[model samples]
Target: MADDFDVVVVGGGINGTGLARDLAGRGWRVLLAEREDLASHTSSASTKLVHGGLRYLETYEFSLVRKALQEREVLLRSAPHLIRPLRFVLPHAPHLRPAWMIRIGLFLYDHLARRELLPGSHGLRLAGGVYGAPLKPEFTRGFVYSDGWVDDARLVVLNALDAQARGAEVLTRCAVTQAQRGADDWQITLGNGRRLRSRALVNAAGPWAERFLRDHTQGANGRPLPARGLRLVKGSHIVVDQRFTHDHAYIFQNPDGRIIFAIPYQERFTLIGTTDVELPEHEEPPARAAIEAAEVDYLCEQASRYLARPVAPADVLWTYAGVRPLLDEGGSASSVTRDYLLEADAGSGEGGAPLLNVWGGKLTTYRKLAEDGATQLGELLGKAGQPWTAGTHLPGGDLGRHGVDMAAFTAELQARHAGRSPAVVARMAHAYGSATAGLLASPGREIAPGLFEAELQHLRDKEWACSAEDVLWRRSKLGLHYTPDERAAVAAWFDAR
Candidate 1:
């Protein structure tokens, strides 16, 4: 078919970006269209953990847990620069789920996957462990487990970059306004008045999946699809001055049954969050205002229950919220499934075009989700390509010879950048992995006072970072460390450049 693309993905979130990379790498012509800048949506607003959703075990989502657990290692290996292991301390509270149940859950979690680099879960004497110094005296016992943290936005960009490098077209600020199936190909119209044709379509539009399908009619075959629906749950997080002494994160259970994380963010700050509340589907740019007084009270109450110092909304330096487009599972917000559901509305024949809709998914399982999506697309398109993303590295993720040995990588980085703080080296190593060499290649030159001029230029030149928010909030958490004046200076430099 003489079409603009073989596959047209309608969202620039992680799922769409990953799928684009997967399909493009498999030698298919692919085009990824995003309404806004990439990762401006839920992709950047995640809890920043590439975990197996350990809590999902309570819901008996074994399959989802297993897939996520397996993907955790895949992500850590592929993007060691942007993803790293994080130790989480779960205090054994008598009021919460019993310790026996927790232990059993942890046991199942460890056994679900063939773990390699990350260590297994272990019981801890909170009074004797490194985390003990920061917690209250009463919390004397806890459990420590491993999960991976990610720079969610960069994950999207890296996938897009990889896809572009492999013969895919990635269009930012281009919205898919309309679509129609024409004979053997799908005709699509963009908001910018551009038209394109594709043999297949993927509605991996995250929150906009339903709307995208609703605006576009069924294909010529008229196959029925599930009435597209999603539960918009707004999750909010607050950033404050660092509160804990150790690097370990804390998973605390609130009285209301929701869980929160106290994570060490950007070295000098703590990230604590997330309250769940139902929101209208039409709410664009899910407002951080929904971070209610009650939610803040709940977070502070939970944090105070464990930490040596008290936390309150007044202590908050920044706050943000994201709407999780969960598949309509007909349950309370907390019980909703985080797994994705794919709806295909294409017929079986020589003159067939397909429309694939993605309902729900998390950051941790994005790659696997994309691979699976590509496999389904292959089936629909009758295209022959073996799955190849499991071992492939994303952009700037090549750790030559060292082979995912973080300790040795950090040691080398510390030696090379002797004048920079150890914490800075560690942060860069975690953010860029072996790619840190590219970031620090110009050793003696200062980028812009606190902001590395080279880093800023690299972001601008390569990462599709157009605004200050794209750099500070999404690309890296350097904003947390920079003063208002310094941030303004960086913004001015970006504008001037």
Candidate 2:
């Protein structure tokens, strides 16, 4: 018989790993199973911001905005290295919304929560400002607001790392093929022959939430749960070479009454994204390989509306898409809410082991969702204790307040690793923060321009990175820097390993 655990989480995305980390920290024996690498899906393919959904205000989603705003500072503190404050410029478009309306939205965005780290939004003159140089001369005025940029995939790895550190077992590439509820416990069967018994189960399977519930969460009678209240929305992003020299990002307004963000990414790229198109009823999780031609053209057209240099398909450096598993609200995909809903068999009085289904969450609310989900399941298992995730740091997040006091941290890392390139030290500091000591303890040959052999091994051993895609794309954005030959070499190294 497989050993019993307090909870067995059946997803390795942010929500599932976050719950595992939180519950394990609370002294619960936890195990998490994922069919693939951590953050291989929707969580990694985000606009990569930790901000209150500013556009949601127009939809009158003030509560979601407030909740998201409240969690922004908390997240910035938790992963200082991966997340940092960014200023976003919203160029005025009289054809779209009026100045007064934009002001109201910015006002609500600033005051919706207790913001301590971020500066409030304010108007800006575009004539000679850093935020205006790349924009067309017609955009003479704009609004500058505070949000945060994050390495979205790294955030997931950090949570899983922290969970493992707290004694939770994280199983990547291990799918839960079936689960059977037997009285107060659940017997889970993995894709492999391994099995596990747990007192509670959490289905935090992002885009596959509904399908997972139907196929994996079985009852004593061996039947799946009824799949309901779910909608899949595909959000796509396009990356292009840097169009501007500044650090600020832009929130462009489209004539279609939708908005898109063009943010500075990885020092030499501009990341633009996100169209909300509902997936077909038959399609569950949309393809990740290519963004639709319409999506690519839409993003280029929208960004070109503001950029002095119009973008085209030929300018695209990368393109990716992910399907959001949202609550079915019978609305247009763009109009559908970003708020999350947590439901449980325990609450519905289903007489078996507790099962929590995580549905419809954005990156901003992931930590809060984890806390709430963990607290709920904890209470069901009579292990409810002090809520401890807030103000707590994720792995390598121990940089000081505002996450800006990092000069010393980088300098110190460079000093400690004498004879190492300061550039490498700086990059590692941003990637691993205070944990750079372990990663740099041994000298490593440079496998690629910025990547080292030791770094690849560390990811494989510590973070469960199994492929070139895992290390290059998700663990860090090294794929953007690696030459084709370098990428092949890295893949070969993994094969040998």
Candidate 3:
């Protein structure tokens, strides 16, 4: 006999976890399967902003912008600890875009959706303020706008945690070897030799969506299944030592019409880049996308045009890349639609099990995508419950009742952990939020600087972290600060256990 489920979701990225969370909460017996650690790919390698794509306005993607803006407000309120309001400075470049056009665009961005949690956009004099200190003297004027920053990997993990709490079985490092569609259910075999039966299946495989359907799934008639065409675009980012002191992020417009962001990261670094290089169909998406040398030089050169101190490849402390599986719109990589499409195929007869394929989505819109995906599933599988995720929090997101005032909560945590390092306590507050109290309930040994054994155990037991890479890099980004011996020690701790 096989393990049975109402829904079986493939891929453990943001979309897969988000769908599982929503479907399971609505009373479905859901199982989410991931081939590797959660967010080991495209999901974790984002530029890490929850914003209405400001540049998308140039291509007249107003609807997408508006939808993202709406979700930005909702997501900010949902996870105050993990998501925080960020101010962005767009330095004026009259040659690239006239000031009037920019003003109009900012107006639409500000008013496109209901605004409450974040402030609106405004013009700024970048001649002598904190925001102007890092920019070249030529950039005397600019515009300031509001968006939100998120811990991308942690966000994915939190959604999975919530799904499990709602009784969904989340399996990591588990790949689906074969899936045979039955008239009313799907018979699936896993790499670990487990069998599962589900009434419905969702392919939320991100960049691998096309391949998953083509190679791993079989139709009821024993025929091959066709998948939606995808345009794979590789985006790369570089992290350098902090160049600016302020909390504000910078959005630089390049001569090629593409934009790059220089955001303050981890309190000590400036995160930049995202070159849109389209990958050929013949190329296979790798487990982790590697940043190209040309991409790094392009980012450094473009950013140097605005900053007083030029950025160089040698200055890059770390680099990452992600392949976006966008809908095939036959345009340039940067111009493709970030909006998603959910295509559901109910196998040939009445009461047939359905297969839903999720395609083309961005970080800001994952929640809405999941909601829409669930609505479609309900129409095919029968309604389980009315939408409940729109008003609910994701795990440790309950900082308060009315709004997410993260500062207030951080200060409260600091006061309680007076004996501990203020920085460590603050980091915990930001990463774990209200769960910080439970995280520090006992004084477990500090394995490395600011990383305690208790935190490692929590990650292993509750967050499904099996390796040092999951805990150090994806879960917390403490890898950047750890010494070689410290990192080895972490790996040893996992091995011993």
Top candidate, metric TM-score: 3
Task: Compute the lDDT of residue 58 as modeled in candidate 2.
Answer: 85
TM per candidate comes to 0.93, 0.97, 0.98
lDDT of all predictions, in order shown? 0.82, 0.87, 0.92
CA RMSD, predictions in order: 2.7, 1.7, 1.2
Pairs with steric clashes in candidate 2: none
Error of 1 at 392 (Å): 1.4
Best by lDDT: 3
- CA error at residue 223 for candidate 2, angstroms: 2.2
Alpha-carbon runs more than 4 Å astray in model 2: 287-289, 347-350, 400-404, 415-418
Among all windows of 10 consecutive residues in model 1, the one with the lowest summed lDDT is 281-290
- Residue-pair clashes per prediction, in order, are 3, 0, 0
Q: Is candidate 1 or candidate 3 better by TM-score?
A: 3
Q: For candidate 1, give the lDDT of residue 289.
A: 36
Q: What is the C-alpha lDDT profile of model 2 across 137-209, one tens digit per residue? A: 9999999999998888899999999999999999999999988887789988999988888899998998888
lDDT of 1 by residue, 369-488 (tens): 888888888887887488999998887677777677777788888898787777767776766676677777674445445457777777777777887878887888777777888788
